[model samples]
Target: MTAEEFEKEAFALRPELKALASRWLGTPDDAEDMVQDAMLKLWAMCADLRSPIAPLARVLVRNICVDHMRRHHYTLSIDTTDVPDLSHGAADAECIDRMMAVVDSLPTAQQIVLRLRHIDGMSMADIAKLTGGTEVSVRKVLSRARKAVREQYLHKM
Candidate 1:
């Protein structure tokens, strides 16, 4: 990507990238720093990057967050509270909360893949790209997560 294109993409994606970084790191300032770091890394490799900036930025931001966590000796725990409201009525809220708890009990990888696929409505390929895994692997993870949630939820219900 050219400098001008990179600049435009970076500007446009700032909010989204920052939000993703904040979500991963749990602080807006840290999120901003990470986004800038990702952007700098992207700028360094702008000439070699062939894909669209969005995917590349996402992958970089995720990597930066992981690196930050590792450096700070922080355990990686995905917040499951962002689960979308699938409840149609007051009675369904309890069910939704129960399901979310089940989801929370899942492995971190399972939680991430499940939320990205079902809650965030991301595509398998996109999840694979973001998570640095194969689409087949993502599919398998999602399948296992769903099955686990189903089995556990049935017991709870």
Candidate 2:
């Protein structure tokens, strides 16, 4: 289809797609923006899209909303400058070394899961996909790894 025809077809599905995006993102403006972006992408790929446009548009807009959500996902930030120093020195380094050893002692899957989550800074969803497991399973592996390390650290102390 031509750019004009693609835009027209995409426009017909805009309200529905926009509402879906709004429900996910909790803002009409962002929802509209996502819909507009999906349209532009579809326009670029219009000639290549032989399938019906409505379902494609709906999936594209929803995926856009999900990507937006992921990009804006909240994460806890640590600022040591705001924390009172409690003499974190050689003792802390030793503790971190012990913890690393403990993590190394864990089962391979748990170790990989823990490293992927904290060291490589991958999201649980991503780790799960990489490890061929569900998100819950990945969480379980990470939890077990942490539990092992904590247990070893506590016992050492």
Candidate 3:
């Protein structure tokens, strides 16, 4: 693609790229950085692009976001302490604690998949590549994890 065409395509997909980055990075600042880095790389290779740009842009954003998360050790840290005293018709603090405990009790794979899919808002394809699993496997794991979380935790609350 020509430089102008690549620029236009990149501009068109910038919002999507930012959204994907936001999902993977968790924080807005990190998401901005990921999007900027991905765009910079795409710009550098604009002259060599020979295929449709949207998927390539998404792939680039996903890879960069995963790399950033790995390099920075950005993983979810579940904290189950400090349950509030919701005795007088307030929110169910004890229920939240129970839910967290149930989530903690799940297998590591299930927990990771749940966090990456729900907490991080990543797509199944991206999660599959990130975890080195097949897309079907990722979907199954996510579905199982969600079911377990709902059945074991949210159902009680």
Candidate 4:
């Protein structure tokens, strides 16, 4: 892709890429950094990239976020502390906490897939690309994760 084409295709998706990073990293500031980093990397290899930069850019951003998490020893975390007070008739914090516990107890792949699908609202194909798994495998993992969380949460109650 030419530099102009790369800029149009890749830069147009900046907000989306940043949002993905924010969901993965848990902070918009860090998300911006990761997105910028990914953009630079993409720019370097822009000539080899194809059109519809969405898929490749998403995967690149995911990889960069994962690397950052690994280096910082971060796992997907749900900050229950910020959950609205249930006493005010907001969302059920206890239930959310219980579900989070169940999710955290799952295997790493399961947790990642579950959160990416349910929590981040990512599509199966996008999740597959980000996680380096086939869409069918991602669906299976997500199904199992959901089943496990439901069973475990009910058992706990």
The C-alpha lDDT values of all candidates are: 0.90, 0.83, 0.83, 0.89
Q: What shift in Å separates residue 36 of candidate 2 from its native position after superposition?
A: 0.8
| Cα-based lDDT at residue 121, candidate 1 | 99
Looking at candidate 2, the ten consecutive residues that score lowest on lDDT are: 81-90
Model 1 TM-score on a 0 to 1 scale: 0.49
Q: Could you give candidate 4's per-residue lDDT for residues 107-141 as a string of tens digits?
A: 99999999998889999999999989899999999
Cα-based RMSD of candidate 2? 9.1
Clash counts per candidate, in order, are: 0, 0, 0, 0
- lDDT (Cα, 0-100) at 39 in candidate 2: 83
Better of 3 and 4 by lDDT: 4
Worst 10 residues of 1 by lDDT: 81-90
Rank all candidate structures by their TM-score, best first, as comma-separated numbers: 4, 3, 1, 2
The runs of at least 3 residues in candidate 2 whose Cα sits more than 4 Å from the true structure, single-residue gaps closed, are: 74-157
- Best-fitting candidate, scored by TM-score: 4
Candidate 4 segments exceeding 4 Å error: 76-157
lDDT of 3 by residue, 50-122 (tens): 6578888899889998888789887698664543445778657767678678888899999989888877999
Q: Which candidate leads the pack in lDDT?
A: 1
Question: Residue 39 error for model 1, in Å?
Answer: 0.4
How much lDDT does candidate 1 score? 0.90
| Candidate 4: clashing pairs of residues | none
lDDT of 2 at 127: 98
